[model samples]
Target: MTTYVINLDLPGAVQSRHLYGHFAEHLGRCIYGGFWVGEDSDIPNERGIRSDVVEALRALNIPNLRWPGGCFADEYHWKDGIGPREQRPRMVNTHWGNVEENNHFGTHEFMDLVELLGTDAYVNGNVGSGTVREMSEWVEYLTRDGDSPMVRLRKENGREQPWKVPYWGIGNEAWGCGGNMTAQAYADLARQYATFLRDHGDNKLYRIAAGANVDDFGWTEALMKSVGCVGCNSSGVASPYQAISLHYYTMSAEWENKGKATVFTDDEYYATMANAWHINTLLKRHTTIMDHYDPCKTIGLVLDEWGTWWQVEEGTNPGFLYQQNTMRDALVASVHFDIFGKYADRLFMANIAQTVNVLQAMILTDPDTGALVLTPTYHVFEMNTAHHDAHVLDVVAKDAPVSRKIGDKKLPALSASASTKDNSALISLSNLDLDHARTITLDLRGREVTGVTARILTAPDVRDHNTPDAPDAVAPREWTEISRVDGGLQVELPAHSYVTVSLDLA
Candidate 1:
């Protein structure tokens, strides 16, 4: 048996609800058949967007969504996507498929999806293959309420009201697909582009500079120094963004041999998890770097791109980036979210790589039937939403004695995080043991835990995943393995599971 202490008296960073953010890109079926099926399709859609996908996203109560492109954003010309659907120009998605791209689902459709999901919008601007005037005008089109040419053109296109977009990324991966610029080079471009990126009306933009690839502390240092768009002035006055971005993915150490998503040995699982735990080191190093530049921690770390990146599904387009979401993905997400919650003060926001039909998606769609099935990762996010906006509770847990390793690496057999709100508390727990269940005694030192309820996501096999034909094959089940006893709660956590326990604080 393992024991843990939840010190209710000691408060941690307030878990930013935006930490549960999602990303949507224009690659593969993510836009066309994934989330957008024209009004004529039988899959039940709202003005073109798939109804089922919309409902699933709404259920998660997502706080924010990033749009346009991953690498596609840089190559994407916003002007080419608007005006008239049929009149819109067709071009090749060179960054993604190198296939012909349609301009049907553009800016308006994305904002509509955000409105339908009741979430804020985080728009990434084009800085790689686009000019400064192009991105500046794009922001003007979406935000400006004045009677300018762009605003008038926007109203003429149909939307009478300007959409609110608080978050904006100056670019994506400037070190790589985003023009392959050097750290200093990208920093100079970020400042130039952000200079003309104006804030219209009350929609205050949170400009995020393209962040370091992974462990590129120099990029962080350079961006912090040059990104003078959000905070202060030439004289230093301050409303403050101080925000920069970061991107990380859980791969098999090598992308060429990413291993199978739904079929992996315990050895592969251990390696993947060890890589996920590597985020802790990245955060510590990056934040340490941030402290040097902005000691007060005013600058936020935006993990805009994350989640598992496995090989493409069999027979799927390689450029499409379609992959299966398995039990391992659910575990990885829980661990990442736990880390994000712990550093919520500086880690203001994060978005999983791709939302649907893409890397580690919450929902998977079938092309033939247009069917939608929630993945194990979906259930984990669905169950963990209670911790949104709650202050994290400082927890100290005893690790399970059993240890699992792959090659030269090993990870804690158990992981957990806790948070509390007004009269409510949420505790998310994960058991990384490939086999063998662990009994845990949770001692809430100074708070009463009542009205306890839990939903656990686990399966008979760690690789078990849901297909369109078996959508319910692996879903959350009401967990009755918990019971209150005096000052503590006893929990029998199933192996390879992610459980979120909700308790009414008294």
Candidate 2:
């Protein structure tokens, strides 16, 4: 039996709900058909957003949403998507799929969707392809409170009040698609753009600079040093950026031959876990460097773009980036969320790559039928929402007996994290073993474990996924066997599964 002692007395960072955030990009059907069917369409929608998808997202209690682009963000011109839907000019989405993007789902539409979902907006500003005035005006247009030209234009466009977009990404992947500028160059440009990206009234913006793309320690160092505390306070004080953005995705190997989402060998599965574990390493090294530059810990690390990226589903546009999610994706997400919670102090926020109809998405909407199914990744998010706003508790546990080596790394069979709020505690665990059911023994650390509830998402087959017709084929089921035990609570975690147990502590 694997043993873990939950230390509820030690208070840790309050896990930001934004860590359970989602991403929506203009790629493929992510926006046009996935989220927007138009009010006129047969698909049930309010305004232009899909009602059912909104409901599903609401159920997950999504904290924040990053929109309009992934690579699309940099090339995106906010003007092209505003004004009148018909009068709003269409543009080619040169980034994802190169399809014709009708400006139907512009800034207003996105904010409306955000309001409907009741989540914060993390707007990825157009810095690469857009001019300083353009980025400045977009922020002004959405956030300016008074009757300025931009505000007047916004009132004319339909939105009278401003949206409190607390988080703003300076650029995305500036080292890559956002723009191939050297780190020093991007830093200079970031300062210029941020100077013009003003704040209006109570809608203070938390500017995020495009940070390193996974293990690029040099890029992180360069941005921190060169930017020298982006949006830094004058008088030689240091506030830098509220956060530095980081992007990483779980993958088996090269992009071209990255193992298929649902079809992979045992070695590939364990290897992917090792790769997922790399997030731990990256966070520590990056945080260490950030401490060196900004010791105050005012600067946070925003993992804005993260999730599994693999070959698009068969027959789908290669650029569309629609991949399948199964037990593998769920376990990967569990590990990532645990890490994010453990480092909530330095890790401010994170957003999964795509929320729907894209890589590691939550909902799969059938465009023709409008039927939807929640992916395994969706259930994982739903199960762990209790961690939001709860103080993370340090849990010491012995490694699972089964350890698989991928290259120089030994991937643990089980991963876990714990958090507490008031009289309740949330413990989430993932078992990566393919064939062994491991029993986890938890030491409640002297707290009264009055009530216990558990939810498990594990299928008979690790590759099992939900189709539009068979949505429950791989969904969560109540774990009925969880009960009070001597040391604490002992529960059976099925191999290759993710589980969340809520405890009512006295």
User: Which candidate achieves the best lDDT against the true structure?
Assistant: 2
TM-score of each: 0.96, 0.97
**Error in Å for residue 365 of model 1:** 0.7
| Weakest ten-residue segment in model 1 by summed lDDT | 227-236
Tell me the whole-model lDDT of each prediction, alpha carbons only: 0.86, 0.86
Best by TM-score: 2
Model 1 Cα lDDT, one tens digit per residue, 1-506: 88888987677788999999999998988888888898889889999999989999999999999988789999899988787899999989897878898898889988888898899999998988889899889889999896899999899899888889888889899999999999999888887777788889998888888899888998998887663333334555442344889998887668778888988888888788888877888888888887666666768999999999998988999999999988899899998987887687789999998898999899989998778999988988898888889899977866545556666666778888999888888888889888879888888887766688988889999899999788987899899999887678898999898888888877
Number of clashes recorded per candidate: 1, 2
The pairs that clash in candidate 2 are 69-73, 229-240
lDDT of 2 at 150: 91
Please give the distance, in angstroms, between residue 426's alpha carbon in candidate 2 and its true position after superposition: 0.4
Error of 1 at 467 (Å): 0.9
